[model samples]
Target chain A: MERKSSDRKARAPSGAAVQKIELTEALYRALFFEWAEHGFSALSLERVAARAGAGKAAIYRRWPGKLQFADEAVNALGLKMAAFGDKGSLEADIRAFHRRLRIVFRHPVVRKILPDIYAEAARSDEMKAISDRVAQTRRDEAKKVIDRAISRGELPEAIDRDIALDFLPSSIYWRMVVIKSSLSEAQLRLHAQGTTAALKSLW
Target chain B: MERKSSDRKARAPSGAAVQKIELTEALYRALFFEWAEHGFSALSLERVAARAGAGKAAIYRRWPGKLQFADEAVNALGLKMAAFGDKGSLEADIRAFHRRLRIVFRHPVVRKILPDIYAEAARSDEMKAISDRVAQTRRDEAKKVIDRAISRGELPEAIDRDIALDFLPSSIYWRMVVIKSSLSEAQLRLHAQGTTAALKSLW
Candidate 1:
């Protein structure tokens, strides 16, 4: 009685659908690898398909072009970020956020891919929209952390959410993203704790 | 009489050399504009030369090729940064830094070109060297700030320089560059004041 195939197979994919999903996952893996190695300007669909051991038609069936492919892939990252959950206290929540960000930043492909995304966003309106969407999702997630802290009375009711948002995640980002450096465990804890103190100044 | 004409213009440039210097400046300006508009991957030397109202010979006279042109221009930026002097206090110094960075980031051409530079750094060793040189210069400047603070007893003798470095400049950069937004004067003041408190947490 299901109208479209979308809801029907999402819960339990049959044999061929499972195979197709696996193939799609392979294509994504290959796409990111090639993009990392060559930079975004040189991303090749043929190479991605060949590396994935899939036909070009497989990509076309999923995405009309490279831009569509990339947009969808980056859009899927929102789900990756949504995996973050509440960690009870403000410090714990901020620490969890930094740890998760560090894991994503530590992935070599991701390190290579992020600057390209920023460069692409600068060049094209389409890429700008994708970049904005990714940022908005992160902010939405960040808001949840701030909201929980305020409710817990760790933060005051009159806090500047924008400034608090900046305080919550920026130091680690500047360290990992701008400096292209990894943080030791102690330093990560310091970022969590230090910012927990600093965020209070926002009020 | 002087060695290779390099010392000839130590004091002054007169005649055709003056004209040549102006043309070279124009070429640098045009090169950055084209790079900002088209991105590093699509940067075109021919377009740059034409936009400057110069010929291909003008470019060849300055450098061997596009890579050399870009490298030299980026290297010249070290002089731009060297213009920053000590502001006599830690917070004033950081506020000056943020003000300088804001001016740079606000430049339409610079805003467009920076991400491409980062992306290029990721993809090419030559670019990585250039990027590292720029970061090294900034760190050297940052170190001067921390040292001044330590001497003034604003910070302790045993502060963690690396984490302190992260604390000083990141919040504004994260707000400006990563989120791609501007800040108000009070918010800038708050960043300086807040970090003055936060940097002590590293000790």
Candidate 2:
């Protein structure tokens, strides 16, 4: 039976087969739900397999371990960058970013999953590295927005980029996550304006 | 034997009371170490008792359960506002607050324990309430510094108190915890100055 199964898998038409892709999607979706519900430390491959209704061997075949599985599962959820478009002005751009942030935070899966990831990152070096890489990528993308503002003469040339980079996200994260503040659309608008004003004053 | 032991315990002098106090201290210390190493979900009274070389009954006698014990243990470690003495000027006061914050973050125990608490708070409602109460207390204390600054004419009357209250700690927390930035003394000073500048611009 083992030999026949191996032969069938080897003879599969192509590596990117539709059935395999569907199975992978099912597994990833299951893994995400498991993570959102139980968090990282409680997460196990067996649980994920059971949740996905897939075999443990199939999961192990795709990802060697839990960390690798979690990394890919989270990434597949678009955990990296917000879909930010240019709004032509610094204030508008910041508002758009904040609006996107509010939407992201409001996601049912995201709110539950992100805190788990953050907590895990705090405890585990591997998770920290993964989180740091994601943060750095996001920061780089945000830096482009600042650069555009600087070029447009909205922000002065000598403004501190490092502090500027840290401000918006940090402030928003602190309010939304740490303090658990229920900010309305108007309040978000005010926050965006305050942040942009702070940035302008940095010159 | 039980009757005789109870009779003897009832008749014990001040020495037994002192020994019990010492044992309680030892247990709390052990709990801190266990929590630092294992986080809240993994913490158990049995493990803590064994680590402290105390009996489980002794732990039960002192605190009804794990939550109470954990709460007291964390509180005993001073998970509250730091000692921020008034420095008269807005710059001096802000800098003093930052310096104290750096010291708090630098404590070996704090670095190990805060992440666990944060992680636990994310998952458990009971833990979240405890953490929120603690956060609220600290925020109220921080608000005093801002109030003083406003009263001292450093920040204008029209300044948004809410955003200013959120900015310094949130920014510092983002840098210290999220980014894990190892800030130098000079960097902290610059951060303090920039925060105060931002507060000023809020007017």
Candidate 3:
């Protein structure tokens, strides 16, 4: 059965198909949950099929193997972090980006899976390439923010773009993901300001 | 056999113990390598035993179960990041700490396992508590640095101590562990300086 049928069935008034869980989404959710629990090397396809209430053939029909499943699953997440709108100033831009990240990390599955994903990327070149492509896109987005600030005369050209990019996400990630702590809205703003100020002061 | 004897035997002239590979050390190595390949969720004790040239009972003898074994293995690594010597300047202290971190992330297994450990910490309370305690010690160490900077007249009392602590390791970690990228010595120094400047610019 085509995966898109699950989406189409959701809109239809069909009796049995309406009750069936969206096969594709259920499988994707199961994939993340299993990855969070068992990890990639030990992930069990039998269990994933069971968890999703689908047969093994159903999964193989969607993807040939685990790595292919992983690639597709991650791409579907569409991490697309490059869409931060022009917030007018570096601090505002940083704060907006931080808010976006905070939302992503708030997802229980995402938080559990993100670090492992990075670890896996470091170990497997295929995963590494996927992760690197995503990261480069985000960094390219960051470079835009830097360019805007420089053009606006809020930041000098001498400010270290590489270091500035690093500063934007590092503190927030350290606080939320690594330390598993939450900060107040005020605290978040102060940090955004701090990053802007820090970035402004250097090359 | 006591784990310490492995340490003792490392210095001994015995043919078997010396040439046979130290059981405890070998097990630790095997643990990291296995974690790197399989991840914690899929980690197999049998494979770890086989790789270490020991039996599962040997692992069971040291620690009761997977979580307990994880606790001991991580502790044996002794993160102890709080011991940065007085470098007479915040910038210098940051540079020194960055160097130490650079060394840790340079290890191949560590580069692979460190992110997973952090990911695991975010999921399990037991692991979270361990990572939290480790983080707290490092923060306390960072506090001492800020205190020194204040005393040395390099920083003001109003500087954002929480954000500064977050700043210390986040950038280097983002580069090495998260992005799986390396920075040159000059780039490392620039980021350290940027962090110091950023921290100094805020309260």
- Best candidate according to lDDT: 3
True contacts kept of each: 0.54, 0.29, 0.73
Pairs with steric clashes in candidate 2: none
- Candidate 3 runs further than 4 Å off: A1-21, B1-21, B133-137
Query: All models: lDDT?
Result: 0.76, 0.73, 0.76
Interface RMSD of each: 1.9, 2.7, 1.6
lDDT tens digits, residue span B115-195, model 2: 556656766787887787667656776787888888899888777777777776776777776666777876676677767
Name the candidate, 1 or 3, with the larger TM-score value: 3
Residue B22 in model 3: shift from native, Å? Answer: 2.6
Better of 1 and 2 by DockQ: 1
TM for candidate 2 is 0.82
Residue B79 in model 1: lDDT? 25
Ordered from best to worst DockQ, the candidate numbers read 3, 1, 2
DockQ of each: 0.51, 0.39, 0.61
- Estimate, for each residue in A1-203, the C-alpha lDDT of model 3 and write its tens digit: 24554665666855653334378678888898898786666678889989999898778867778877777777777765647778988778878877877777777776667777787787788877767765665677778878888998888878767777888788887888777777788788877877787787675
TM-score of chain A of each: 0.79, 0.82, 0.84
